[model samples]
Target: MKKLITVFILSLLAFTAYSQQADRFRFQMDLGAAAPKGGGIGALVNFEPQILVQRNLALGLRFGVAGLAKDIVYYDIPKDFTGEISANTSFSGTANYYFNYKKGKAAPYVGAGFGYYTFSSVNIESTDIDPDDIGNLRASFAWAPMVRAGVELGKFRIGAEYNFVPKSDLQNIAGEVIGQSTNEYFGFTLGFFVGGGRWGRFQ
Candidate 1:
């Protein structure tokens, strides 16, 4: 998390130094799919609220969640042990800093940040275990890196982004299980912007 903050500060300084050359503030909304590097479907939708403080720089908060699910009737593990696994979802939020570059109406941007995600609804079944044996898993808080790009048309904008959340073991149903790692992701977005007078804010 500290590392993520350090990067954001450096990017903010760089954008501030070059933002005086542009006009107008920028905003955006985005949706996309997230796939787990180890397991789970890479499906998701994201709505990001952003403010372009400078022509070359912007800062915003990403408020949304990512989910992964699959249905299994049987399993083959170290033993013949198996039952049924249903679905799971992960939620995340973070502060994002973007460095934007542009010419005329086209703008491309990239960003990175850190956030926390909660993993829930991970269920496994076995004939030896009762239905009441199922329980919720604890949440994991970790550092994540994200990247995004977009285009500006008038007061409206369209873009997409991919957020990568690394795997970390903060808590688990089995009391801190190890060797279980996964990733979370976000795909595309659509958004709008207002204010900042005539100084290209989203430039």
Candidate 2:
């Protein structure tokens, strides 16, 4: 019985090493919609390159871009806003921890990241203002934090993330501070990856 157990343990260890080395790295592409806090719907795309650091941990760098339609709040004037748009681009370093239970095909993960975000000035045309009077709201770059959770089944990945971004001052073409707009958003994604050699914890 002791001899049999020893052989089984060795076999398991070999298999585990093989699994980890099969695909040490992978690339992922995700396309999804973003819902801004107190704003209209938008879309985003993310490109990530990931390296497996351990059996249950991976590290990645994400390049992402998104457009959101959020409101602008004026400090002096009581404004009734109508249409709005803001463009955002970001680059972040991320780490994911996976939970693949007992060779199960599905791997669930939670992760966190911090990135630099660039925002284009939001343009909002109030129904009360003149049509040609619309000025591009000036914006600035910010450093933000992100949190995400997801499940990966084979090559396909489904995930959701929230970006905590700082609010920026809305300035007109004259460079006068007019109001503020929240740059935070929630994103949902459905995409697939090219590596990581089958997502089971032990198989």
Candidate 3:
């Protein structure tokens, strides 16, 4: 994780240097919703800093957090178990390509990102199980991949993205696999961005 963060920072520095003569540096904030697999809709937030290195290409770093929660109940047993599952904190680096780079006109874009994700464990509380038997149920660090598409109009942007994190086994304090979960979700965002520079004839 440390190595990955280091690499992202170094690459951002290099890109910033290379974009010195480019069009603009963009800073954007996104607020949206996330729908995780088997979970209800949750809130999502993202902060991105990007530099346009070309007429149609931009490189950026994305830091975001999303949370999902769902209530669970166990049946078919004499003892009843009920609790909730929560997932949070995702960060990534992204590159986007704009189809039309004209100012004052809406430009549609597509992008992909890769990053590290951490998720909290499923917490279960039941009338039958003792509190002592409940231990931390944690998930390992997961490699996440995402794809996004959006339209940018003037300073406003709206987009949707889907993140794919493979199924991870949930482990207890005894290192026993008790269950498995996948951190896959779809998100929609609305953002406002500010930047200065010229892309072609549009300033």
- Total clashing pairs for each candidate: 19, 0, 0
Assess candidate 1 and give its TM-score to the true structure. 0.56
lDDT of each: 0.46, 0.76, 0.72
TM-score per model over all chains: 0.56, 0.82, 0.78
Global fold similarity of model 3 (TM-score): 0.78
Q: Report the number of the highest-lDDT candidate.
A: 2
Ordered list by lDDT, greatest first: 2, 3, 1
lDDT of 1 by residue, 16-91 (tens): 4544544523334454555544344645554443445545555655545555543222122332222112222222
Residue-by-residue lDDT tens digits, candidate 3, 58-118: 7788877777654333332344244444646666888999888554468788999998887
RMSD of each: 7.6, 12.4, 3.7
Across residues 1-203, which tens digit of lDDT does each residue of candidate 2 receive? 24333543564455345445567777788989998888778899887777777777877777788888766686656863643654477878789998875577788999999988887756666656653554776777789999999998888999999999988877777888877877789999999998773765442
Q: Worst lDDT window (10 residues) for model 2?
A: 1-10
Model 1 residue runs over 4 Å out of place are: 1-26, 70-76, 79-103, 125-134, 155-160, 168-181, 190-203
Clashing pairs in 2: none
Q: Which stretches of candidate 2 lie over 4 Å from their true place?
A: 1-22, 131-134, 201-203
